[model samples]
Target chain A: MSLAELQRMTRGRGEPRVKQETPDNKAALAFLGPWLVGVVALTIGPMAASLYLAFTDYNLLEDPRWVGLANFTRMLGDERLHKSLEVTFTYVLFGVPGQLIVALGLAVLLDRGMRGLTFYRSAFYLPSLLGSSVAIAVLWRLIFGGTGLFNSLLGAIGIPSSTSWIADPDTALATIVLLHVWTFGSPMVIFLAGLRQIPREYYEAASTDGAGPWKQFRSITLPLLTPIIFFNLVLAVINSFQAFTQAFVVSGGRGGPSDSTLFYTLYLYQEGFGAFRMGYASALAWLLVVIIGAFTLINFWASRYWVHYDD
Target chain B: MRLTTSSARRTAAAAASIVVLAGLTACGTGSAPGAGSDGAAPELSEEEVTLRATWWGGDSRHPLTQKAIDAFEEKYPNIDVVGEFADWGGYWDKLATQTAGGNAPDIMQMDELYLASYADRGALYDLERTAQLDTSGLDPKVLDLGRSEGTLYGMPISTTAFGILANQDLLDELGLELPDTSTWTWEDLSDFATEVSEKSGGEVVGISALNNGYSLQLWARQHGEALFSDGSVSISPETLAAYFQQALDWTASGAAAPASHQAEMAGVGLDQTDFSTGKQALAFSQITQIPAYEAATGGATLEPVKIPSEDANEAKYSYLKPGMYWSVSSTSEHPAEAALFVDFMVNDPEVGGILGTDRGIPSNGAVRDSILDGLAPGEKSAADFVAAEEAYIGEAPEITPNGASELDTLIARYLQDVLFESQTPQEAAEAFIAELDGSIQSANQ
Candidate 1:
């Protein structure tokens, strides 16, 4: 078609739409292009490959041989997988709720008018920042060791102590859970932000209505902070499910003291990289995505009952 | 959702243009490496070949390795070497990804723990034929570690022997003689450690009670056990039980640090503890760790001795372990060049002098001698000690299971369980065995 003919054919299409020069659109495209590439290359690429890998027997060396859900089948019979699931579920069960409550409680306490609030807030939040760090994990091990600072302090107080708090299987997971709780600063900060968002008028009104401090907290603060609490709860669940660095560093990346600290993601990492079971690891990864997704969805569903967004 | 006549055409045209642009970009990236499409060696040119090499090391080793690479580049004007270094913590994860992406370095520093995994995956080039490497000068044991399926996938860079480093000064004060390492048993080590603690009014223990890879290996050896035999989980129930009992007994009697303390040390590593602080008389480590040990102890004199074993004749307890290996990526277009670089790094006298026992005694005998001769006094003493121990190492054991590395975590966790709570030896042992079996089974499938 000739340019003249093509122009003539479209001439009657409403008023000739004025083409806008959108520097913003051009800039947005330019800006997002690299980000899109990175997401595809670094994140989505592996994710897509992992999905494919889940059904195959792809060791890092050879070509992936598709076995069609054999990995999932094997997982059913895998007692270690079962144990890891149990341990991980237990971790998510205890760690997520425990961390949220503590974080919220601390956030509330820190929100009160008090001296050295900044210092106390920083000191508590400091662990959250450093909690996942290798150094902090090492320090945690030392503080909890039988001859560690904790036992040493106990001894100084004339309490007899045994040398192994972290080594005992029963207490090993608990120690990690305590670690999860100690790093409550992240959620605490979120809760603090949430607390600040609630107008002072609600609490004041509650006070005016002859509501005691406890009643005010129960009726106003708790309801108002529900969104943040829910947010923290969901985040904690996902984070707990994917906990790797702590368990890895604390247990020397072995997830042990009898596999008590073997978080699900750590096991996935071990399978994929350490054991070279990339295929199985991919399956595990997808399963985790499903697990986290389910938990997050469930939390969202549960939020319907408790989370109050005081519009 | 509805488009007018001109708008629909514009949208279609835009989509077509996008498809073309993306296609072109993909083709451009895909074609970049294909410029040297022929797998044949490149035609000689004046342009320098900037070869990228990566390895994991601490700050101490980084400078030395950089210096060595610089010296190599200086010697070979056509080769410009780029060095990428990281701490050991997550090195393997990076290497594995690089391998998967088919952009692995020309030269990669590898660990014995990963040699099989990398080689089996074809992520590493067979250096033997490609380099036509003459192993006439290399240690047979070190050479053996680099071999997979009768082909050499890597060249051993150095040797390390795991053992207990006793603080001689502490032992002397306690009037406790270092046991005859060759004939000493675990029981002897434990008993002596307890005696020192009791006698010294709990001021010191005979050793830093730490659960480590060396401890696990040593324990397996002591009970005539193998952590993995013939590429299988072969640790006997009796051996596992004995190992657990020994750890528990030591912790219970206060002869060693409690499990939790040891667990703490697990992350920090045994090199950073009361032993290095000049308090604990003995600590477990590899011979290559001597440099770090000496530095941490403030130049306090230290010696590397064998991990005490029950049977003196059984060499299962101790063997010359390769500190590191130089591997050429299988995907490399220039395998010969990579192999040549490895050969130069290992056998060249100048490179050896610069490296100077930095990566353990060089796997090559000639290079080891050069490094030994060039070493400063302290390093020279370490070299001498290693030479003496070398004569006593028996037949090197078979390569461990593909999942052998996972067992280290299992051992550490079992020990951690014992130290933290009142878990019995049987419980820890059963858990370890079960976990090991599970890991091995999963790996096999």
Candidate 2:
């Protein structure tokens, strides 16, 4: 139903509906009790505590001393924090879009009635399941080391590439970006579901109107898939912002080769755990939340222009 | 609708009050270290007590430590010890989190660089007041290395002197006798390394340039300064630049592995270092690591020589470093039991025999003498090197200041910049000093 029609209907019968729904309120609240308790105890509680900690000078071993805004001001002069921001932004700018393109392309390929669809889907999904794992990061290090499989393959073709992909500062961040892009399985699955929901009759209608595949995709599929694309875009942006494990494992926790692969979260970890500056780390954490929140909010605001939920 | 809204407001109010109650309870449970328990008079009891002992090492060290723990339990009978071990990379991060949570193990293995930090924060128990821990057999100098401010916070488990580890097979292949380390200067050593690299057809570098702060400390001492003194950078920027310049020259002269190769070898264990892997003729190592290098080379003859000095008979660069310490956590429920365990690990010949020198040469004179006869040839050489170097060894520098652990990585990062030619030695040195001073100041704050 359209918004105007629903609003008119609600105004006419809202009081009677509320009176009827009151009888079921106890059952509804009982069902929600577990979820409500969890939010109050775990999520909201820690978030509130962390928010308070962001303003203090806490070294974990000692009690937090309120230093008010000093932690935030320190960022103005922190060279490492600036470098981390640059690195994390670079990853998100390139990685998220690259991942989405690959995911959509794969989903389109699978949308065709290929044989053994389940097997192919699972095979493709395996990387996303294992992508953030320490084992995969270790495997990636082996694949990109000075005398690793990648160089070996290059040598087979007579190129003789001897550079350590993960050790060279020039190529270290790029290697991490490739690792992020390699895990496109989750978005691809979502794309596949979205594709399935598009009625086949729309395509048939387009075909009858003499629309070719490209034209149909541009007019029908593209516009219809915007909502799903926007959803994936938001999630990918947030995930890339918080990327840690790959860089941490690959760099051996020092964020070295000149700190080229120091993700924002990894740097925060180094400050909090490695340097024992918990207050500064807490401030950095809050800054990250603001940045991620701003990006997500922008994405939602922009979605109204393109996303189509109804015909 | 009105009733539902009112009920929702009431629910919100209840949650807010519960959260306030939770915050208050959490504040009450902050458990000040050593406050709840009678720290000075922890009673020894026949009642059953279990304690967690944590340390970091390779696969070999883990089993030996566990064996020692098992022996301690057998001897005490009333105490059950649980072992926690991790590789060095994740060890500090885990320890910090556990300590902050007030769940640190009863006994923890600690490094000198981190000893003062933990001790100053009141996370470590004062061994002098523990009563059960007997330190009469330990050298006073060695014991003092574990002290912060005025009190002993950790017990020295072993002492290892820093020196050079040479691959004898490669040295012999090149038909070169070991340089006379007692009189050789850095210049002479560089020449010797260049000759080795040339003779080996560049298959082996003469030396693997280390980005270690300990190595820098030795170099600084040779120039009659300390890397750190009284919680500040004590060495001049000129000395540091010259040290890094020497490393750059080694790379330029093909006496050290290329920058990319060195980066790959950074943080690798003894088994994978270039010297152990037969890719370098000499590498920086502690006396305690000689056995592990020998094992990695499958019984190849590896020898320890003194770290070369800058002047003839003027530099006292070598000192015995407490390999690591056995510390009792301030939060440990059984401080007495933990202290007894440390004493057993140190003085018990059976436990010493099981552990050997994996933790470095035993700090106790009796334990060291007892284990000497049973030592393998490789282990004997390391122990002998320590004995021979005793006359030349100087006073141990002050326990590394807080933030000193980060200096190693900072030095390595700048060293890489020098090797990669992104920064000159002078520039790297200046940046290093600035960064080190900044970290030290912040850490002190």
Candidate 3:
């Protein structure tokens, strides 16, 4: 029904103004109880605690000592801290693009309408489900280990290699990046959903105008998919920056091979839990908030230049 | 379509939530080593007490410890013992979080490096006044190893010493004979290792380079220095230079595996080391791991050879390290029961029989004598090796100082630089001293 017609029906041609019944506020709150409790207790409570802790020297054993900006200043001289930042940035830079490309490629292929659609979608989505798990990380370690399956695979094909990819300073980060790239299923799903939204009539119109598939994709699909692409890009970048489990399990928790796979989160964990430097770890966390915040701000600003809308 | 707009908004909302969640990754619940449960109750209560006694070891060690716990529970039916176990690295992290949360385990297996770190922070119970934990069975020197600032925070459970552990079967296969270990110098050891490597046709290394700080201590002692003295690094740069030079020499001569291979084996855990896998004729090991290594080697006979000296007739500087200790959490409500459990772990012969040399050679003489017949061949030789090396053993070394638990990590990183030739040995050694000194000073603050 038209909005005016619905409004006229509800208003009865403006004959009289009727009073609206108020919701049972207590009942509504009761229904929202679990979610409210979760946000307040799990999210807001700890967030406040960590904020206070960020400015103090909490070594876990004693009461937190106020250290002002000491923890932040310490990061300036901490070579390992800088290394972890570099590693995290490098990971995101390489990993996000690789993942989005693969996800988009598969999404495009699947959008062409394949048989066993459900099965193929589920199969492709499997890695993303298992990718961040400890079992898969351990499998990565074994697969890239010195005498691991990868080397045997190489050996069987008349190539001899003995590199422990996860233990090599030069190659360790690359292995983790590849692991990130391989788990492109979630973004692929998003891309697929976005693809379905583009009107078939638009493609028909474009095809009648002598546009080839590449030109059609460039002129039609690309612009329509911009918002989805932007969404996936930001998510992927943030997620990549926070990557921990694969690096943790694969590198045996020290982020070894001389800290090659030391994600920022992993280093924060080592500082807080391993060394009992909770205050410094809290400070590191806030620094990450700033870093992630700045990146997000940049992403939002950049979106203005490229994001398209039907309006 | 409205579906299109809602789906896009839904996806955007989902992505935003992920970002929000990831931003809160710093919100943590675990705690660390600390003083707690400083409750007014000091006396053992008649009430039913449930104690969480935790330790770290391989899967094999778990059942043995559980058996001991079973025996303890049988002895004191009113007191229930809950056994918690984890791997070595994760154990500290767990204990720290628990203790910080004021819920530390009642009984904890402590390491030398971290004993003072915990005790000095008041995280551990002071056993100085506790009469429940007896020290009469342990050597005076060995007992004193647990003391920090006049407080007895840990009780020595067993002791072990470092030395060259040779895989005898590998040696036999390679047709190599080790020289008399007691009289052999570093040069002699190197030559023998090179011969083994050559004989094995590069299939095996003589040893994996010791990436840990323990070997640094052994090397320093041989040169009349120590890794740390008076709460700072006392090992001279010259000693470090020569020590690193030896690693380079070994690698260049094919006596030790290359840096890449060594790095590979480091992450594979103790059971997969070159010596454990029968890929090396000789490797650095402490007496505590003899049985485990023997098992890892798939039944290869391991023979303990004394660590080679700078000069055969010089001071041996051999000291027994109290391999690990039993500690009580200050936060533990059942301190008396925890002490009793530690006492059983050390003094009970049946418990010793169950643990064998798994922890190390038993520290209590009576317990050691009683368990001798029950030990596996691998463990028996380890016990015997300690016995035979006793004549040359030096005075027990001081307990590790606070803020030094991560020295092994620091050393490992610098040692990698040395192995990878990223920095000159002298340069890395100087950097090591500066970083360690800063930490020790700040830790004292």
Candidate 4:
């Protein structure tokens, strides 16, 4: 019944009636209560605290003291901080593009009907599953060590190796970036899923129009896959920026060979936990949040120019 | 939609149960304080209290320590102890956070590198003020090691001395006799290592380059210098240069593993594949580390030989280092009970025997004597070596600054650059001094 009619029925015209609550509304409230509690307790609460800590000087052993903007000011002058920022930028710059291109290429290759396609797709997805593991990082370290299997293989080909690829200051970051790029399977899987969503009739129409595979991909696949590609790009960039465990494990948590592979999160780790500079680390963390947020915003803005949507 | 609703209900129910259980546990009157009939009994109340303790160790250590904690709980049925163990890579970070959060455990195992920092910051409890402490049985010397600014911050659980663990089988295979620990200098040891590497056709490395700062400190102490002053680095530039040069020479001749490999083994304890499989001929470790080394090689017949000194009186610089210490938190609600438990853990015969040589020979002299008869053969030899080297041991210093641990990392990194990057000792030294100054200064502030 209409609210006005109900009010008129319940009370004389022009006199408001108070509606009583029902069991269903109470049940709905009960159901939504836990979710509201979790959102506040787990997510928003810590976020607010961390933001406050960002402005303080809190060593883990001592109570946090208010020190307005000092941690941020110190970071601005910290050489190691600058170096970490540079390293993180280099990683994101190279890793995101490399991963996206390779993922798309593989997705297109797997889009065609082929024998044992299921096995191939599963095989391609394995690295993404195992790539972030400690065992893989350890394996990566051994493979890139001076006397490692990689060097042994190189020796068989008569290449005299004098240095460890991962331990060399000049090459360590490159090696990690390569590891990041190699774990392109997840994005490839996502791209493949998006590819399947594009109807086969569109491709057939392009074929009838005498467009070759390149022309067809440029016009149809590229435009349709734009959204997915953007998604992968944003994810890869963020993950690359936050990369820690690999560098921590490989460098023995020192971020060494002269801090060549000192990713930003690794530096933040050393600051917060290593040196007990939780306050400074909190500032760094918020700065990272801002950075990732800005990049996401930029990607979303850029998407409007190129990304196509059917809906 | 119906299934989703049902599942949501299930999740809510589960969550509610968890919350209820947690609240009940939090407010439970399980550990209510009580007075004994005599009101003077030193025994803790039968009321139950659960506490969390954390430490870092290898997989083997995890089980051993867990068993020890089980034993601790069994003896004190009223106390439920939870153990949080992890590997060395991130141990300090975890402990630091727990302490900083002001929710630190009633008991924690810490390293010397960090003990001083924690103590100085008043994060640890002073045992002397505990109502039930009976430290009268503690060895004067062992107790002295934990004293900082006239207050005890830790009780020694084990004493360790760094020495070279030689593979006797490898020496016999090389047709070489054991180097005399009393006469061998650093140069002599370096020569011997080079000879072994050459003879093995580089199939085996002579020595593994672990103990980055210990080696440098050993050398500097031999020359009558120190790494730090009242709270700052006091080592001379020339000493550091010579130390780096020697380390580099060893690496150049393949006496030690390459810098990269050594860095990989930095915080890994003694369980690396090479050490475990007897791939390396010699490795450097502390006395307490013998069990790990021996177990790794599966009793391959090894001996702990003194690390070579640099001069005639170089032994003066070498000393028995404390492996680890047990301390109660300053914020503990039951300091008296904590101290009594600590004393029992280290001083009582039954507890000491059961915990036999796990942490190393108990630092308490009486407990050490009691456990001597039951030590494993390997542990006996290790204890004997440390005891024999006691006369040459240097004075144990007070707690170090919090910045000291970070300096250790800085030192290790610069050492890597010196060995692997074709950087000169002079170059590394200057960079190291600068970096050390920066970190130490920051810490001082």
Per-residue lDDT tens digits for candidate 2, residues A65-99, read 78999999999999889999999999999999999
Worst 10 residues of 3 chain B by lDDT: B25-34
Best by lDDT: 2
lDDT of 2 at A227: 88
The 10 consecutive residues of candidate 1 chain A with the worst lDDT sum are A16-25
lDDT of 4 by residue, B305-362 (tens): 8887666554477755556777777666655566666766667777776677777767
Please list all clashing residue pairs in model 3, or write none if there are none.
B31-B96, B31-B97, B32-B96, B32-B100, B34-B123, B36-B331
Q: Which regions of candidate 3 are displaced past 4 Å?
A: A1-23, A152-159, B1-42
For model 2 the local lDDT of residue A178 reads 95
Between candidates 2 and 3, the DockQ winner: 2
The docking quality of candidate 3, as DockQ, is 0.24
**For candidate 2 chain A, which ten residues in a row score worst on lDDT?**
A13-22
Per-residue lDDT of A230 in model 2: 94
lDDT of 1 at B157: 88
Please give fnat for model 2.
Answer: 0.38
Q: Between which residue pairs do clashes occur in model 4?
A: A60-B100, B124-B330, B125-B330
**Interface RMSD per candidate (angstroms):** 7.4, 3.7, 7.9, 8.3
Q: Which candidate should be chosen as best, given TM-score against the real structure?
A: 2
Across A190-305, the per-residue lDDT of candidate 1 in tens digits comes to: 99998898899988888888999889888889998888888888888888888877787767777766677777888888788877678899899899999899989999999999
- Which sections of candidate 2 miss by over 4 Å? A1-29, A205-211, B1-43, B174-177
Q: Which sections of candidate 4 miss by over 4 Å?
A: A1-32, A142-164, A309-311, B1-53, B59-84, B136-141, B267-269, B273-276
